[model samples]
Target: MAVHPLSALLSGLVLAASAAHANGDAPAGGEPAAAAQVAGLWCGDGLLHEFSLRLNQDGEQVEGELLRKGRVRSIEGRIDGQVLRTQSTKVGALVLEKQGEELRVTGGDGPIALARGTSFRRSPGATCAS
Candidate 1:
């Protein structure tokens, strides 16, 4: 089987996740905290379904990639404050709302309720770390 770019990208992102996780829930040095955690991959679970997202922040804008099962392409989004809005290339847009240790992305036909518990892991060569 041929290796997919997103697969490697996903793996790399997981590594980033682990490093970025701040168990303390707060940043030291009195540095300003970001509204959204834009430093790695995130996985959202729902019964048999799952979603993965990676946010690469450059300055004030965030470049993101969304991966869904059965689909090779990924959705894209931007972040500002505690909200993340990604525009689907095919249909609708998803909104990711981050509140403390919890996060939720809403869209699709069903209810837009998602739970947060840091499903994303750190990859092999990650640059984002605490």
Candidate 2:
């Protein structure tokens, strides 16, 4: 299958964030930790579609892959305060408000509530790659 362009972009963003973190270039404050808290695999099941997202967050930057109906799209965004704002080629702009462990996604046709997928693993050794 041909790789999606958005996937490449998101992957680059993740790599850049990792490099910045490694270089100690990440902004100082609680933002990094706060963003880190949002890093995980999240899933939402609807009557018509099942949505899954695997996110890696460092500082205010977020990179992830969203899967719905067997189609994978890359997500790139930033967190400001308690809201995570992201955009994808397929979904356009998406706003997710953090409420406890759930992310209420909006800015789409309809809203979706995504819960942390505790049983989902991004890799064999990594629970959710960061």
Candidate 3:
């Protein structure tokens, strides 16, 4: 069964949120606060599943892997203000923005099932485990 990259990507969103709460990073709202830096682990819980993403930032360049169901996809991009724009040779391109404590999907290329505005939380101390 071939899994769509977008589907796998969105799945990680749910897990990121779960990890955040477990780490005691969540506020009363049950969501963790967003970090100023893009370099770290992020998780998101989608309507259907969970997923994780790990990012490393150096200056303006950002590189990371999005993980779901033991599969990993490499992505690279740049940051401008609160927005992170990333591209993957296998998964295509995606754009995310930090809004308060959530990293929301703002845009993307190609036909994607992951909706724009789908959000993920910063998973501090969370590792991108397969």
Candidate 4:
């Protein structure tokens, strides 16, 4: 049986988030209040492709994953002032600026706009094995 592209991407993001929490990078219980504004899941619906992103911000350090059709890539970067700068294996370097509940990506193959979505979130007892 072949797994759906979205399923594989979600699985990869969950594993990455679990690892980050275990390594003391991501907050263990929940996202901190300070980072809540930029944390959680963001989704983008484009003409040709749809993308899902999970971002965990611990102070200035940001770690996350991006999932698109045929691709699952980890992203690492930091929040510099008002913008979040990250680099992905699939998309290269990108700059994200939050505008209300949306994130605007300017770099890589973007100008992509991702809106807040509830499909993915960090639970209190989330683990890699789950």
lDDT of each: 0.53, 0.62, 0.72, 0.60
Best TM-score goes to which candidate? Answer: 3
lDDT: which candidate is best?
A: 3
Report the poorest 10 consecutive residues by lDDT, candidate 3: 27-36
lDDT of 3 by residue, 23-80 (tens): 7567548754443477787886574136777889987789998777778888898876
Clashes of 1: 6
Candidate 3 Cα deviation (angstroms), residue 92: 2.0
TM-score against native, each model: 0.47, 0.52, 0.63, 0.50
Better of 2 and 3 by TM-score: 3
Model 1 per-residue lDDT tens digits across residues 13-119: 76655555454223454344565765565554443136556667665466666556545445556665566666555545556666554446543322322333233
Q: Which residues of candidate 3, in runs, are more than 4 Å off?
A: 1-36, 111-113, 127-130
Put down candidate 4 lDDT per residue, 29-62, tens digits, no spaces. Answer: 6453233256776765343236667778888888
Candidate 1 wrongly placed segments (more than 4 Å): 1-35, 107-130
Query: What's the best-to-worst order under lDDT?
Result: 3, 2, 4, 1
Select the stronger candidate by TM-score from 3 and 4.
Answer: 3
TM-score of 4: 0.50
Better of 1 and 2 by lDDT: 2
Looking at model 2, report the run of 10 residues with the lowest lDDT sum.
Answer: 113-122
Better of 3 and 4 by lDDT: 3
RMSD in Å for model 2:
16.5
